[model samples]
Target chain A: MEQARISARQLLMLAILFEHGSAMVIPLGIDAKQDVWLAILCGMVLGGGLFFIYYRLFTYYPSLPLTAYSQQIVGPFFGKIIALVYILYFLYIAARVLRDFGELLLTFAYPETPLFVLNAVMMLTVMYAAYKGIEVLARTGELFFFSLYFTAFSGIALVVAAGLIDIHRLQPVLEEGWKRVFRIVFTQTLYVPFGETVVFTMLLPYIQKHEKAKMVGWLAILLSGLNLAFIMAINIAVLGADTVARSTFPLLNTIREIRVANFLERLDVLFMIALVVGGFFKISLFFYAGVIGAADLFRMPQHQRLVYPLGISVLLLSIAIASNFSEHIKEGLNIVTLYMHIPLQVGIPLLLLLFAIIRHRSSFLFRKQEKK
Target chain B: MAREGIKEIFDAIERNPQFRTTASVVIARKQTAEQLLSVLTPIDKIPANQMIKTLEMTETVWGENLNVHAGEIIEDFSLAGKEIVMSSFRLDRNLKKGQQQENVQFVRPPARLRASELAMFKNGKLVRWISGEEARGVLWILNKIKQTAITVDWEGKEESVSYKVMRAKTEIAAKMKKGKPVLTIHVETEGDVGEVLVPIDFTNPANITNLETKLRKEIKKEIQKAIQQAQREKSDIFGLGEVVHRSYPEKWKKMKQTWNEQYFPNISVHVTVDTFIRRTGLRSNPYFP
Candidate 1:
């Protein structure tokens, strides 16, 4: 039972930044090769459809968060278990994105810095933001969104002015054909950054205006999706599809190649800024969702006490997530995307929606039969 | 410019916006970095940025010289593991353009821009320089040819026909033939008759067709010469290796190790040039009968 309310605009900004997050820094959908942009567009379509399921569930229990509403849908015992699993899922993803940004900064800028140090600093900052409550986090997102796009657009302008883009690099479209593109769309792109918006279900009840929530959510998804696709296309066009696929961070490499008049080269800083801002918001939102959900399920009067413990766990979990950066990436792409993301983001929400529907229909039918 | 760590130079340029940057770097090999920088320092009396503008306006328009920035080198050689081929120039303070002043008390050495040479680099080391028709031939195969005036003999030694290339596109395809990679370079270009010293009537459609046939042969010869020079040097500057890598990733992984030394030097390449004389410029049939 949180009293703070955020406007629809803040919700939109948070979701957009959440979707952008580390997804922008790391190469997403690169398995599709030159048609990676096409795969992102396909993921957006699937993600948009998935949003409606969460939206309908929100409609069923508008006054309560997902953790509380699951109890009403099923019985108390099962709903508490589902809520606990979701809380753990949010914390897990928060840790994963935390590790992603930490690894990027370590590789690119801070080679000597320990991974734990980077993750700890980021986790501490996120803890502060989450402790401030959802309203402050949303407002912070509203402020950073403008600066994020400013760097993004200016970075793109420099790349174009440098004359690095080669349209032919994207040529022979679907060179390997549609099968690979769709496979990428379903496995990695769809569940990842896009379907990961399922974390927002815990925060939906905090919006000031419920009527505008659906539109804002969809708009944010569409805009962030297009932004990702456009950036990937530019990366492939500038660096070529093969180099892009091979790159650990394609966007970072793409920005590095932007040298307009020789004065504007070495612009990986802009990429770092964008990634940090994006990663901050992403980790904060998931951290907030997990904190509030845990509080709701545990019947705590205030969620503030739980933030520090959970934040420390996230920091530790990020470091303990994998042995090395490659293993971390591999586990995220191959193992986690299949095992954790699909089931929690897509499967459970969908089944919860189905059960909610059945409960509604059966109750209505019983009432009708009693009247007869 | 090539002596300094390309990253360090770029970082310095980025830190100070007032110093600004030019389109091309003066690459030197024989001289020390201090000598090259000092030689370029005084030449700033005329300002090289303005000179770059002049080159872009008069030279790049006519497609004689091109501007290759440091970023292209970083991307190609550092990121893509590809060779670098760009327009090369020698500082000739003696070579001046337009009219010369008469009996001047103090005459500053004029830095004229003339690009007849191409510098090729392999793994950050200067390999060799190719000039004359061979350089233009490389540009042709790379499809970097813009509006270049190609002069062809007409009627006799006194008369000539110069075709201006307005647009050009190069398509390179690698196909595995009998388990060996073969390359097909197709150059498609169209241009107008820029200057004609001959007395032929260009208004007639048949005459334009006849001129295109002759121009095609000249272009083919230039491209073949360039390709021959590249193969001889064992340099894959045209990024044919990249094309092969894109077409066949698994195969390239094996070929990449010995690409420049083994595969590129021995591979067979087929060149095709398609040319068209679209317009006859401002005047048709010339001023003569």
Candidate 2:
């Protein structure tokens, strides 16, 4: 295997997507109300713990991807089964991300452009970078990271500076009560983005030095968490709790309200550009990881060739899986939030950690007995 | 290692091919603009003098043409203008004996009046009437003489005698004293009589008490009427509604359910009145000077 190097910064970029994964749905805060930020904060704290678990796993098995390590730890057959399950999970996530990006573009930008064209264009870009290898992906992430942060922060500042925001809207704090807040934090926040950091396992092998990997991962998780919390707070302050809860894309709509001197209005174009670029990076990274995992499972000589086929498959899968945007959003919120998001994101990783710990303890006991 | 390299080459071939298409479109548009500009310049050139002259003429004519068009468009429409006058009139008219008359008083008689006076005096013994203390005494003596002569004449005639008399009375009281009755009489033969009353009881203690009581009652009624008018106008200057709304939001919400019926009726009201008499009407002294 070629040595593929990635900086701590690249890891931070990857962590941002996971940490802010729920951002796309933050606009739905209008439905969630005052509890939205609480949900986000809770997600961050819980997601940080999950990120730590992931970091521990990667630190324990430094050189191997999850696919090979699981097989070594558990028997080959069980390991293969688990690897297959992970492969499917990654591919599904890739497809969902593609669909999410496509839906956002279609809803906000070009209504007439076919989704296949958009997905294909994005997949091509991802495939090109993936072929160049993980080093290319990390470098690309590095190049875009600052611009991403600049666009995001400037957008928020513009919205805040518009002076239309009413601080009284956050009054009667915890109007929905703590129970709903806790439910949202646990059910809506922790499981989705925080747990999704499990994908970091694949990238850990490419890290240049393993010494500070855990610290880097923790810092990335924390920074991403704080960023999301700030975003949610701004959305609430700008749009009000009720409006934010009802909105499907709270941050985007908040940015949409940014107008400078009346002549420079409707800067949703800036947001759309940033979103499409950021979403491309996120989806492509997942797609590449899925292809590599699939190739690893089959013992294929090369994983790069699978990129196009998998991209096409995912593009079609995303289109066919949901009937329309409403259905997709509903499923994402109601069904996926409960089942796929909670169990896969949180449950599987916890189970894997438990298994790893039990195995470590038993091996320690067996080694002591042999020494005796 | 060779096989991995071969696989890598194959993977590269499998990547998306759309970037080339977009790049080509951008390149082509740039290339075509240069080609078009290069091809069109030399073939359609006119002399510079003619071109300059034509351009100048067009610029000069365009302004006039636009103005003419504007005038023609305006001519087809109707325009309207109006002048408004406002005036306020003051009327001063005196009613005397149910007849309208213009009476002029001269400070000094003109030459025509002197001539008319001399004509009147030339007929016989002259008689004149003037107004002052001396004239009032003379008028009294003449009135008595006329009355006596009329009586003698009537007595001598000895047919019949008819007398018409009228009387009026008012209750008068001093500021510190009790009430008193005052009477007035008028006697006339087919003539009109008029009299103005000068009330002398204003300073009486009884009259003062009555006036004070009446004035206080009238002030109270006036205050009530003003309050009723204010309520009818729905002015909440007293901030009663604000008090109720703030103190009881839920109750206010319920009250607002039928605000028109419940909130306006029997509304809490308070009023304070202060009165000062600066001057009395006409009679400052008990008797005429």
Candidate 3:
């Protein structure tokens, strides 16, 4: 057994934590307006199908990671090229998540705090976790899972108790019909909080219950999808579609409106703590993925050796990611969704699956002839 | 103040976590806000928090609640929705009377309790005050009426009867009439006879029916007054525009730009009330009867 392997349950928690870290704060499937819940449902169904494809690919190459298997599936020349592309993709995603955390801190928690300093500190801690390997990361994620749910659920529970969530705001259900909701599900929303599950393709190979990894991956996507939909629905119900659309952080704004009584106010602090912890897990997982991919692609013996250098590079890349917050938001909402996400998260993965099936069949045929 | 001068204050407030926790926003007219801060005492046991509690209790029991929190104000005052109505309080002019009631003056300061007025805002600035019956009507239309009282004149008699409302429900339908915006307000409420001095058979369904008609008329009067006042101020504080947007999205897209000034004032408003007197209090018939 690999020294740093995780069980199916740990894998599920890590994926949920990673997807939830950013999705909970930023509004998901919002273009569908009050019917964003429907958008999320449609998107999740499609997201599950996409995850299954990735899982199928994983099953074909049970012992090998994406970096090693790409070369085997494709010719050595193009396969190494594809592997290098994935390595860069992981690194870039790590930096993007780092930027998200740093920008969030700069915007809400610390106005005086420099982005570089926040990124540097976060990257160092994330690098340490990544260097400790996936086993420690998985354990840490499993441990923090309870705390995350406690604070997040309690914050939302208070809001619901405060009578701030008006179901009337969600009235005239499917007023615009399912067509518009599905359109939004397809174009803008699916790949974001859902298709971002593609990162798990790398991590899935490390599950100790290798046969059940595929089942666990699909289950993780299913659970996280429902959770994302529920969270977004609560936000829309509390903040209203118009307000939720305008807000930069809908969950933060919703939590701020939670007034249970006189003294039990300002509970956004508790939610903020939960989100920061979640953000840590998200960034570290992506950072871990990047470190592992780099080590494998470069034919290195150990992933621990690549952590600090990758961490420093990620810090620098995150600082240089966007000029300001609005631009970052614009790119995140528009550019990333339309361009990078569709291809890297969805398109290339499907292509990988197709190629994997073809190669496996050809190799099996070659062995059959030799046996004869 | 220069923007930078305010920036320093913002920075300081943000830096100090305690400031954020204890902060209570008081929504009033600029002059009224000034007067409140002036009379607010240093020894007033956390005046900011006290004011918030006071505001909530008044809204809780009175049903004169209008959310004028800063965020709500910004939201309702936007182009999407163009009005803000908040419960308002003033330093009682007759503080001496309040002092007479209480042995210790400081224990209960002379802020008015029966505050049935709402500070009205357009585009985040106070435009006017909707007072008394009109304010209650605003709450009535918004379905916030709780433990409120409404009176009806009984059969041309000088004596009137008041019903103490136990529950109230309201709904506003925003539909177009002849290619223009129109609103219909429906109010359903049940209450007990609080005080009825007229000499009549209180148990008689015939008399009760007459009373119900008068009650509906009185409730309608309040709703009409609120509608008229909203028109006069050219603000859609009732949020009928939002109703329109939800039910009639395409129409709203065109009306939203002029909904506040042009369409709101001119829109036709129809009020309907269903009042059920569930209880006749301790006595079936009045002493006079």
Candidate 4:
């Protein structure tokens, strides 16, 4: 039995690394076109509102992870099933992000390398991070946060210097009216990177200051929001929206365009380093959540023992999840966004929040009426 | 299950570790790049790097001495907009495109190899190559003129006057004329007399005005030649389509599909050149022996 704790800043870093984890690698909502920056802005503002709702739910059941409190909120049988689903979601998402990382490596870096090798390597590292516990993961995240920004900003600067960034490429802002921009904001961009932060609910209980977790959450959201907007803008400015939409790895393309004074060319390696570091944090946090949530639900003694089995399961699932990269991308955009992401990320948590308020505010009255 | 689809391979090559992401691309005349590089001299240096440098110099400083880089080529071909016109060039015994000076005495043997051509792309494929003044015309229309020369001949005079451009600015406006975009390009050039072989009054404002009109006309002719060549090749290397896209994004989406194929050739172009001669070199006329 262990109680792992992290500072509010570390929590923010974890949230940012997780939410921006996948978005940083792939093109974030390519359908948003030149207006993706707007989509990111809208996603953050709205996702921030939703995060407030999640925080409200967490505060009502202080210091208890979702697995522990779902039982108190709902009955035993329903709670176990809900907890199981949350555990599965944690494992599934960890696997999904793992797959995205693997595919990125395969598609961008190593074409000849086996996909399983890439997935397995990431899974093993995540397992190690999870075994070491949340503190190590948080520290690694902090280290990576600076590196990620440094790489991204330097890439942008080089791209600008190369005169590859044409502000004209980001033209015709909101050309389809506010309605079109808002649509993708909710449907596509909202789910993946923004709403995806819902998984962090499991980590919130470990915050040193539980009350300030909301503030940390907002800070994390705003930070990632601006980052997403800035990157998408650069992607459009350099690669243009059409190229970005077609390319599997738009950031890689954008970074590759960075030829500063000639010799600084092909800095996509820097991007690869940052994404790998970010993905490691994201997967580790998700892995930690899944192992802990499962142990808590089953009343298992040691969470560490669950790490290996769970990580191997994830590696296998990640390999079997989709046939290839395109299918994986399609599943993410289509199945994950509409089905798993919406209901779990936004819908279920929302329902839980509503249920918690009713149960707390009116429970005594209901019990009194029953006794009479 | 693994399928190495075309898309996947393309991405791998794009993000490959070995290839330089910022390497300059060369688009040749339906020929291997080696044949083009074969003639590019300075045998000790890499041909690709030299070609890239040559193309870069073509953007701002070079006139007949210029070359268009790979990045500029992509800008003209990118499908985000339709009215895109990029640089066009070629190579031979004579230095074509933006060749500036004629009489440079060689101190030593120059590089035997040279790559000087701007290959215009339409929809990501090479469409045509426009050389000499036409290629320079592309730069003028794009406002990429830093320093160039124009020789305006007086109708009755034997020797001509040459103006050296110090500053050049072009403003291209894309507006709707009927149902399509009508591009109006305005070019302002500031220069000074570099060579005056014919006798002319340096103090007289009338003569300066006279030379300025002749300079404007010459520059206009070059631009017109470029636009006409683009229309002939149906290449919008000028990025005129981008102007339309920025101004009217909603309409552009529908138009972007056919922009390079059908619309680019049909779009109307209006070009105006403004030349202001800042000063005359030292003496008004070439130093008479």
Error of 3 at B115 (Å): 40
Tens digit per residue, CA lDDT, model 1, A6-61 = 99999999999999998897779887989999999999989999999999999888
| Winner by lDDT between candidate 4 and candidate 1 | 1
| Model 1 whole-model lDDT (C-alpha atoms) | 0.79
Angstrom error at residue B155, model 2? 99
DockQ of 4: 0.01
Report DockQ per prediction, comma-separated: 0.01, 0.00, 0.01, 0.01
lDDT of each residue in B108-223, candidate 2, tens digit only: 21100000000000011111211222221121211111111010012233312111111111111112112211111111111001111333233233433343343334333433
* Comparison by lDDT, 2 against 4, better one: 4
Measured with C-alpha atoms, the lDDT of residue A365 in candidate 3 is: 100
Best by lDDT: 1
lDDT, candidate 2, A128-236, per-residue tens? 8767777777777777777777778777667767776776776767887887777777666666566677777777887877887887777776787677767777777
Give me candidate 2's TM-score against the actual structure: 0.54
> What's the true lDDT of residue A321 in model 2?
65
